[model samples]
Target: MPIVKNLVTQMSGQIQVESQLGKGTTFTVELPFQSAEQEEHPCGGTLDNPVSLEGKHILLAEDNAVNMEIATEFLTMNGMKVTQAWDGQEAVECFATSLPYTFDAILMDMQMPKLDGCTAARQIRALSRSDAATVPIIAVTANAFAEDMAATTAAGMDAHISKPIDFAALCCTLGRLIGKSSKN
Candidate 1:
């Protein structure tokens, strides 16, 4: 049996692929990011339909510029508004100063200058203010190990995501927490 993979372009265009036994295929698509007719669908599943990222605000804490760009691009592509912090210290500041409970989620990078993800998460958890205390802090890092997950959990992170972030998994996690479907 053959498998089909759909590569969505910057615009609403998509490249479709079909692969079969003992055979190979290739395709390229060049398209601009253009506004298209909105399609509505039931939420909570995979991101298969266009969704409104209008009011959603995500705080992204990463030390690397390249990583920040990549993450910002991905999150923004899916209709998310993002605030980027160059390191964990800045992340902490952002969380501490911003209106409590204003952010939808915090994507914390494990390896960051100054405060680091675990420390930042702990500080956020330790907040005396109740609104800021329970905000979902999700670990986003390249470190994928049992110990790493355990450590993050101990630090009060609600979930952990291995870097080169998986869109589907992120969507699923957000859905479970925020009660919204990515396929909106």
Candidate 2:
């Protein structure tokens, strides 16, 4: 007889597998549902002074040093903790090796050395871990167009923000994903 068991996590159901006699065996685990702790947005209302992004952790992947510096300063000033990668490859590597659920959101640059944002995002979505796949990835690129938006969305990004990033827009995007409203 083959021994069997069931397990569940915070965003899915139980996954099971079996083995054969004198052979190898395997199993699958389903993730449980994630708890939505925050309340739904009240559409178009000036969010109660907007939500403060204080202490939130953000991962920024941009190959440009100047842009990275500017973004880092902006996010830090708003009380967010920022971790940066110089290119898309680094971003994928970081995400793959992170200490489980370590990121609140990711700001991905479309063009980079080694790997572009699209490929990196697709890889991230295919990760074996649930959180890795579910974490919000927001594309930050200079390509502002309808086609660009469609491409990014198809590549697994949760949202898209054009470059020369607008401070207000960035705040709004962050708020929507993490369940906060613009504080500024």
Candidate 2 lDDT tens digits, 52-78: 678989999999987898899999999
Candidate 2 residue-wise lDDT at 78:
90
How well does model 1 score by local distance difference test?
0.75
Error of 2 at 111 (Å): 0.7
Clash pairs (backbone) in predicted model 2 = 9-32, 10-32, 10-33, 11-32, 11-33, 12-31, 12-32, 12-33, 50-182
> TM-score winner among the candidates?
2
Q: What is the lDDT of candidate 2?
A: 0.80
Each candidate structure's TM-score, on Cα atoms with residue i matched to residue i, is 0.70, 0.71
Error of 2 at 58 (Å): 0.5
Superposed Cα deviation of residue 143, candidate 1 (Å)? 1.1
lDDT of 1 by residue, 64-181 (tens): 8877887788789888889998888898888888886678888999989898899999988887775565677899988999999999999999899886676667766765654432
Candidate that scores best on lDDT: 2
